[model samples]
Target: MMMEIYKRTVVGEDGPTVVTESVPGLRSVSLGLWVRVGARDEVSEQQGISHFVEHAVFKGTTSRDAFDIANSLESLGGNLDAFTSRDVTCYHGRCLAEHLDIALAVLADLLQNPMFDPAELTKERRVILEEIQSVEDTPEDLIHDLFAQSVWGRDPVGAPILGTPDTVNAFTQDDLFEFTGRHYRPSNMIISAAGHLDHASVVEQVEKLFGSVPASPPARRAPSSAPRSYQHYYRDIGQTHLCLGTTSWSYIHPRQYDLLVANTVLGGGMTSRLFQEIREKRGLAYSVYSYVETLEDTGLFSTYMACDRCRLKDAVEVMWTQLLVLKECGITEVELASAKAQLKGELILGAESMSNRMSNLAYDEMYLQRYLSMDDTLKEIESVTLEGVYDACQTLHDEQGMHQVTVGP
Candidate 1:
């Protein structure tokens, strides 16, 4: 099906940005109110305020109680949800085309009228404390956070999204309001929607709901540089969790697609070299894969594996062999073609979801400040040469730049 994407600024340079993707035959629409403030924007003391605000907003808005907020969209066979990431927070919902106005209204109300009641704040504190404990109890999940911290030290990029227990416990109603007031300005927001929707109506409703919000200049905090390091934690778990990672380029780096191609060849799928070498060929691990994560300004390229403690050494050696081979010899034309096909296929398949499309619009705007159509992305993937992939591999495995984090007894 053909789709149309429209981009607009609600007022001017300091106003909220809006992008809508109109799909011809979809019955539902997905909408997101994206604030460019996230865990990465916090200082040492305010570590988890961004995530705290995300949860507190649902406790009660000025017009809707928690129960009412919960049912606002579910009553119409739709759903509302929100998430906090390192770089952004999004409150989003999906509803039938006929209920677009209601969805937008509920989102705007949550942002505009959150009460941040002291009582609700107290209840949420306990929930989030328990949530932090849950992560501590899960070794596989905790290792990534540890790895990130090891890589970036105390920088906001490496800090846990859920924040530490001490930090979360100290968050008061005032803290949420303070952070929200500073970062939730219209200029730092993006409204993106996909599926059956009209650009004009969405823009008009958004302007009425948000146009009056005062603008604030974006606050930029330069990231502190940190060196690579190794860490190991002893746990009573049966299997060892290993994460070997190195730094990479930012989201908008010219060689971003090359990195993607190299990452795919490393651990992207069942056909990927790491999966095949570590799991299928040697039975060293049951779960082995590589991933490329690019934030707004920096990125990480990591390969993760969970295996029997006894097999951890073998798995690490084999993973290293794969990396060295990729760096030294690069990928064959056949492997390159297969990786490109895999990426293009996934990109196309992902576009089948309206939520993905909605997110793509926001992400592209956030990172590139422009829309990158699927065709453009496919062409970029197609343009990655074997030499480019080699350079990407070499960049990722820089000597003295690699870091390792392991968790297991």
Candidate 2:
């Protein structure tokens, strides 16, 4: 049976925007409390405060200890987690539809009243420092951070989310309280939920929990400058990890789908040209893929591959060759049709998850300022013609603006 999905939005005059999608016949609900501040909004001294707060909140809250918070949802056979990104941070939970109250209560406590004990902060700082070391030891993961530094240069958007050891070590309990007090106000919050739920019920609970929290003005973000053309890091690793990319359109732009389709044809899946040529044919690398990330004001289109040091040149040559081919000569009608089908299938399947729907609600509210139904998104994908793909390829693969980062011996 086809489930009837209904979406609604409500904003207070002094706001923590609330949006909900009610999917009838579902047994569970996924909810998230989103904050607008992230790495991009931080100054150099507080590079990872946003992410630090994400971990710190889990340590304990005023009403609950760390163990209680950890077991809050799991005791009900559900899940709870959070993440900080370049633009926002989210603390979310999922549980049976009837237990929605528990999920909401636990998340609200974490958001409104993290204890951030000095002893806890000290322990978390060491844990985060260990995390930094973990990333440094993994070349494949570390290279992406280096790649961002290479691409955005000094832009705050390019700063690592985990932060450097110095900045993280300097963070105190007061720093967290200050950062959260500034960014966790009503104006910076969005409460989103999906699956079996009632919009008014959720809103009423949210208002009761958060009504007294005062609003604040939004933060100003600096524009990103032009990306550098190339960068290389020499590591003693046995294989070369290469990430090559260029700027692309923002998520809100009408042309975003064009870049999506272009990416699918290049290295999105096993059938993609880079995967077929570089891995299947030449056996240069076991993993090679292309990805696109569209931010609020800008985006990134990048390809990554890991290969034997000696084969790095051949692998890069093939990667660029495929990119140029797609740019100079657009994909065939059959290719376009196949890519469209792939995208539609993934979209439809992903929408079935309450978590994905909950996330889509917040993302659209934050970035697009409007919601797009599944039909709307699918139509946009279908509308991408060969000419559109060609234009996307040409625009995204511009050699002058391209950035390259390779980490290997």
Candidate 3:
């Protein structure tokens, strides 16, 4: 199966910007046309433009109207969707193996020939405005964005991937075209497909479809330089939303596997320390968990909980205590082994989904620039020693690295 995984970067004027991956044997296939631009790539005024473009691209393409675009794949028992993130935008979908070419053609058409109609842009602007308002109405979701803004400060990386109402309202049709032209280039794109598919044939299709779109070098934003810090916002809400986090390793960090174990032991699930201590033992909140976001150049370790305003102080104090305890004493041998096993099982289970495999393929090509066999990845996870977990815990929990954000009255 290891030898069955194939990845190669096509080279030429019409060559693919990055390599593609194919993992056979499944009855269906998943494909993603990844572009290297998102919220973080936009200037202050263009905050949500990347995400807007994601929606607009699907409104219609040269060959497919929005209705045809929506039904083209579904009529064949396939799916289609796209999303924008802080670092990248992905147009991805899944379908039965026999329907791979349909998925590929629709996706290629969307990326290469989006109509971006003025009427569609007008309708989407209102849709996005409602989306921004929905987030404002959901405290749990809004608080994380607030936490990010607080910690990352003025950096665009900290900005909400869904831009503010003002920015969303300001995007014009020309703005959409300008953004797409600047960033939607072969040089900044990675096309990945996984499951029952032919690698050479997929490559040929990509070259023929995308190669015609001339490549343009994007003027990307400079790397973020802001230091992590805290900001507390007062809102007259029933439950308080809070987060404590700090910077951690990037995607390529050597000790990230150890960090993964440390995070799991801390609060990766219901059985995690944060959940057990904060929710089960103390009854401080209905929801509590710790998570890490590992990006291309940076990462974040954050723990979030929503609890009664009265117990806010106590909840925060308990969280800090656990952090200090982990930093000082490290996780137990029992906990370390459990976390490792859980992580391994999750990786194996996740691989079963064609969508996940397709996503993994895009990420590896976009960030790692090489294909890593499933065995290779599992071995990396398996190699994290108990001592390594301790080191990771101590470093991420270093007192100076921590910060806090709380949102509620």
Candidate 4:
């Protein structure tokens, strides 16, 4: 059965707020405030400021202290959360449908009226420093950061999303305030809601809450990238973790869906070639997968695995061999059919959630500037062909375009 995904958008005086049509008799609603600014917007001097702002906003707002802010949501048996990434920072929550107005008001207040208390800033700075140290201690997670550094070099886009301890230590309240003023404008943000939402009611509430926020475009810059290279870091550890990667087109590219399917065939699922060949056949490693993350202007295609130090070389060899095989012989019809179906199934399953739907709305408004209907997305996934996926592999598998990062003793 083809399910219809109805979406409505209201361009209030503040900015655009989009609401996905509600599911009949759904239990919860997900509300999100998405700002199109993130770590990538920071310069070397301002690194980590965006992430700090993400944490700080939750600390308190003008009317609600951090405790009040938290209790307000929890009392309703709802959830509150926020995260900062390379390109965007989001504050999102889910609650009973009847409490949607309260959730919306709280999120709007946090965005427009954060207190940025000095004491809270100091506490968050210490917390972030500890976080940086924690990352240094976790090799499985650290390898991906190292891989990004290798691929992007010194570009801010390639820098760690959590920022360095030094950078975190250097940020000030003024810096955070300036960053917020610069990027947290109406024109640079989107409000998305899904699940059991009354579109007209939500729109009316959003206009009243946000109608006064000034709208302005953000200053933009491009990231600098270097050619792919091999980077090895020696650390005394029981297992070696590596991130093997290559460059690929950004989200707007025509071949993105093809790349998505190709990535799945390579190592995405437990039944994938990497999992089958590495674990089932050779018993090299317990964990292995390939993933593709496409941004507005760039993308990363990476395969990650962890294994005993003794098997590192063999594992790398096997992983590289899989890439080469896909480039030369391409995926078989069975693999092609399987990958497409898996991708489509996953897409459908995610549609069952209002949180995922709201997140999708934010992503579309921030990058694509046009809403992509779920039907369109499914069609695109189905439209991918074996030849298209093969060509995508051939284009991305170039030796000159591949980068490898290894961390272990």
TM-score against native, each model: 0.97, 0.97, 0.95, 0.96
- Over 4 Å off in model 3, which ranges? 1-4, 17-24, 212-228
For residues 60-119, could you state the per-residue lDDT of candidate 2 as single tens digits?
A: 998999999989899999999999998999999999999998899899899889999999
Best by lDDT: 1
In model 3, what lDDT does residue 91 have? 92
| Residue 282 accuracy (lDDT) in model 2 | 94
User: For model 1, what is the alpha-carbon lDDT of residue 241?
Assistant: 95
Kindly list the per-residue Cα lDDT of model 4 for residues 289-352, writing each as its tens digit: 9998788888888999999989988999999999899899888889888988998898889888
The global Cα lDDT (0 to 1) of model 1 is 0.88
Mind giving the per-residue lDDT tens digits that candidate 1 earns over 1-409? 3666666555464667889888988899999999988888888998888899999999998899999999999999999999998899999999999999999999989987899999999999899889899999998899988888877777888899999888998888877887888888877899999999888888888877875456564565646546767789999989999999887788989999998999998899999999999999999999999998788788878899999999888999999899999889888899899999999999999999999999999999988989899999999999999999989889767667788999998
* TM-score between model 3 and native: 0.95
Question: Number of clashing residue pairs in every model?
Answer: 0, 0, 0, 0
Cα lDDT of model 3 by residue, 16-53, tens digit: 55355556556888888889887778789989999999
Q: In model 4, how large is the Cα lDDT of residue 77?
A: 98
The full ranking of all candidates by TM-score, starting with the best, is: 1, 2, 4, 3
Candidate 1: misplaced stretches above 4 Å? 12-14, 221-225
Q: Model 2: residues >4 Å from true position, as ranges? A: 212-217
